[model samples]
Target: MKMMYLRRLFTQELCPVTHTDLMGCLQHSPQQLQQLLSGGFAGAPGLESLSWLHNLAPCFPLRGDQIQVIHEPQHFYQTLMQRIRQAKKRVVLASLYLGTGQLENAFVQTLRHSLQAQSSLRLNVLLDFTRGTRGVANSKTMLLPLVREFGEQVQFSLYHTPDLRGMTKRLAPPRWNELLGLQHMKVYLFDDAVIISGANLSNDYFTNRQDRYILIEDKPLADFYAQLIERVQEFSLAVSADATEGLHRNWRILPYEGTKEQFIRLAKERVTNFVQEAYQRQLQRQELDTEADTWVFPLLEMGQIGIHHDSVVTKQLLSNCIAGSRLKLATGYFNLTQEYMDTITHKCLAQCSILMAHPNANGFQGAKGPAGGIPAAYTLIAKSFYESLVRRQQNHRVNFFEYQKPGWTYHAKGLWYYLPNARLPNLTLIGSSNFGERSVNRDLETQVCLVTDNMDLSQRLQAEADRLYDLSTTAERDIVQRQVPRWVQAVVRIFRNFF
Candidate 1:
């Protein structure tokens, strides 16, 4: 009982939104909690002790293009092309893959157009070694020329863990040479906007296969990311270092590798640990709050539930207390950690609702294609994964809602837990993290956790959730009725857990 009150007190110590330092409304009266949640992210302090809250509100509310969630290939193509064409000042792009295909060719055209503009633009690209190489040839061919052509204006680098073949120790004496983990952050930070997403700098993110990208125009977010980029460059680390030295400091540069591969390796290891730890912390941060009738916790649980002192807890702790009731889940795939999946099944059986925004296909990287989007073969794999889930879990009582992507892809990563008030767990998680096995354990993903009573953002996200949940549905019966091959049926049963 006392633990609950202590948790509330700590929350009152730190504010989640507006980056203010309030834990949460700890000892505030019922009326105070009402007024507190009703307030903006960071605004007037609560009561007299919290009066300094004015300092938390910046000079502005982060703004952006307010991009409409899209699903079509043409729109995705046009958007990237436009981004390249309109860029001025500096263009910083980081993605997992930029394959060798016509899609890459078309993308090059846009980049070239930007270079030809002679706007003195600085383009910095950080690409993954795995995605850059299709196992046979180097993927760096796509951006190498720009780096050389633009000279002082344009720059590029490849991020790879060197000589990392087969399987080897990731931390044995810190070989620091073998590139095991790859940098998987898909972000486009320009002078005016910051875009953190799951889509890489490849055609698949835009075409028929299904993809999503979100643009956040908050200047502070952009500036924060930009500084991190500079830190990567200044400290020759991508291919083989720990982290960019003193990442938060501006105008600070430590020795950095001239090549991108070193930076990539270093960046991957650095983020890998971070994601693992974050998942753990988010789960256990909230203390029992029976008195106030609720608990508050960080979206990324640090590591309390982790298997080892270092092993991370990637399992999602589906909230059941009013918070998990009004849940909205958006992921590229339907598979979830065992714990989370069971939690949802239990909650639904008990009478809670769940909504999902899943891409058309579960995203199986298709065979090497001419255009590089997604081949029909890959789509088939995704289709099978969904069918198996429907057939197997019919008795779970969970309302599975699927979202459809419009002319563009919807790559927003979030889990809205609106409990009793639809705004209680109105805690929205936004970032580059994906729920898949590769994302949760292998790749380096970062996301922002925002817990707000802001009805405006919640409304927009909720409406979008509704639209998507009604769009995509591939039932198990549909697959069986279509007379899918026995071999395909067998594969679906065996691998549904993988999606």
Candidate 2:
């Protein structure tokens, strides 16, 4: 029965509409497209009225559920650990890479304790293979140890999307796919509750580095993520590590070199199925709350030409959020693709608040260095995004700001507010989607589209945004008009896609 449904879903191409088709509409009918664009993305022909929200909002099963925004890392950890402690049925952890540190060690211990306490509880962990296998000094070294400790009670799955192999590998640069492709989602699900953030399970993400953290209690949403984990597990390799001779760490899991094409196909299918299921579920619930209408949906985008270029649910949902509304965007990096540029600038909005990382605010990179160094180059590239907006005078419509605190890098990424004059935000985006070409065209990403009617949650979100804005310095025209070095500009244009 499952296979039959899967086949039918795959054949039908479950997206309501594709990005390419939208582009075609914009190209073929400029005057009509301009009218919709002026009204904002949410006001697109099919999505303009409030009735559209009613039609799509009922899919979420929770009512007046709790949704909290955690601005501080300590608070995020406290909430995360508390939920893990309370999870009785199952716990699933997924991240791009689990960095080794005091935080990592402490988390492992907590999980170990939880498993020991509950004999029947099940735990599953999914991580990227390339990142998992990479050697790091002072790493937590828990993967193999935990497997050894819990045996069958704990399961681990590692996603491996190898680069083009054999002759193709030789033709492309070694880091080509590394920069273009990889599983980059960060999700933590504990039974009926879930935590979505761009932060990985590491010290920086838990403490110093800034990122968005959203905690919501909803069984349907949690189950949706759990199902995603299961889909990934099917494609991921069941990894096991053992004591190895002469290895520095004394443990190793042999590498995997498989059919990259087949791996990508399975991964794309997983995303497609997830979208289809969410769409179908929404259709089943017709009487969604009208007074304080709030609906939740999962947005997955995998960068495989036909699959991603056309089926970017995140972009679509973002458009819906922006329809007839202003926008407040926060991201650590500020590199906008043409698509996003069109979406933000062309839309009819009273204002736009964009919070990003200044070169000095980049925790991973330093501002003072050789002009051609990695950190310097990336800083300059970020500035290019600013330059583009300024040159076009889009800066007037945007209150460009950056979070500032010495030594702490900013890594938050998502659209926070999607309304104009409301006391609180009605819609928000949370997860690993960055505002850049890589996130748009190359990474496996996941985020939750949180639509809610709770005034308290809205107030908390507003407070967080206000705090960041307070710390931020507005990017006036003069500040953005500074001349960048010709050399830096040239290099930025060359590597624009990679950022």
Candidate 3:
């Protein structure tokens, strides 16, 4: 009943209220960013990247010391295994989901290997509760075995947003919707080095889903992620004695403990209030809007909604890459949004030559049913989207292809732009942000855009893009169901802004 009351206080059948109304204000996007970008960058920082989550840094840079584009899952997976094999003191894994079979076996082997080798090694894992409930429930079944196999060394929990579903359904007031839209972030940090990526342990995201990761060794970002993991650890401690919330609740696999009325109150009062504060102090001010006094043009855009709605940053990023003379190179989920297609098509006619790599099958390497290994719904969607892009580009003189390499995932997230005979290099932006709406705003995402004078990085990125643009194959958009025959394709298009 107490939990139910807390939840009631949060959501009311009322309209959403935002902290700031920035319509009249004219903010300038930062021009300096336009001049320092080179090569390409990509990342998908969800949930934790929320501008309103906890004590987030006012602004954080998404750049790394040595910018390496990893398109192979084995490269990233082996790298992580290597780290686990060498750990001396502690090993920590924070995840959203861990799928079935050998992938699952491989995950257990790596961590259990260390725990079995040494009795003193401490291993902690914090996972998401959203996917843990239904489906296969692999995460739930594996926990006891981990502890049973390694005993003192292995410890884990399926973390969840306290006021969400499952446990709340039976509670009074039934305020389970509070957990809607909650995100699952993938991170691993230990011994001064942090590995962040879009891939999860499941065969889907790593071997199945197209994904990427970066090994960061420096401060600020590393420190921030490390601290987030620490917070989860703290939550786990609370569950030991019974003060469950977020990470702690899931770690122990505890019940929702609170009532529906209790959850609603908390969602409205605590959750909404928390995000509002984050929006005002950090997101609004830190999101650079306009740019001036640089050879590169500032981003002029519309249809905005995010930290600062209708802001010019995203549009600027798009326009900057689209309005090019020689090259337009990028790699995404290959799902085309209508808005994205319109913008890219317009830019192509304006003289930008386009190229995209990433064979649709690579991300699903060694999978069982469908997207790649079998006949999955996404394959149909991918085919439809790719065909749409091809249709538009073919109508013009633009260069485009479906880059295929022996063992690569094509996970790079930045685009390349080459100007006429000018000596200037290309632009590169990296981070957990994508071309999708969820990436741009819905999910808390972070990105670093750099316009550098470095020709090597720019040239190399452009060359790689050319490799992607060279792939050309017809798609089969056949679907399993007729009603939603175009449903999946429709989703990919709508999500990317096509509608």
Give the candidate number with the greatest TM-score: 2
Decide which is better by TM-score, 2 or 3.
2
Taking all chains together, each candidate's TM-score versus the true structure is: 0.59, 0.79, 0.54
- Candidate 2 per-residue lDDT, tens place, 323-389, comes to 3466788877776667776666564344678778765677646434433244345445545556676
Candidate 3 deviant stretches above 4 angstroms: 1-67, 88-92, 113-124, 133-137, 143-184, 203-210, 229-316, 320-322, 325-400, 403-434, 437-499
What RMSD does model 1 have?
10.3
| Error in Å for residue 63 of model 1 | 5.8
lDDT (tens digit, per residue) of candidate 1 on 1-499: 2233223322223222331223342354454344335443333222222222222211123321232333345575676677778888767877776766788787877787887885687777766545564445345666666655666665454444333433343433231221234556666776767665566666666665444444655554565556545533432223222212232222222223243454444443343344333323322333322222111121221111111111121122243333224555566554454445545554332333333343343343232432122222223443444454466763343444444555444454456555443433344445555555434444445454444334455566566555555666734333333433455445545543333
**Considering summed lDDT, which 10 consecutive residues are worst modelled in model 1?**
302-311
For lDDT, candidate 1 versus 3, the one ahead is: 1
Q: Each candidate's root-mean-square deviation in Å?
A: 10.3, 7.9, 10.7
Between candidates 2 and 3, the one scoring higher on lDDT is: 2
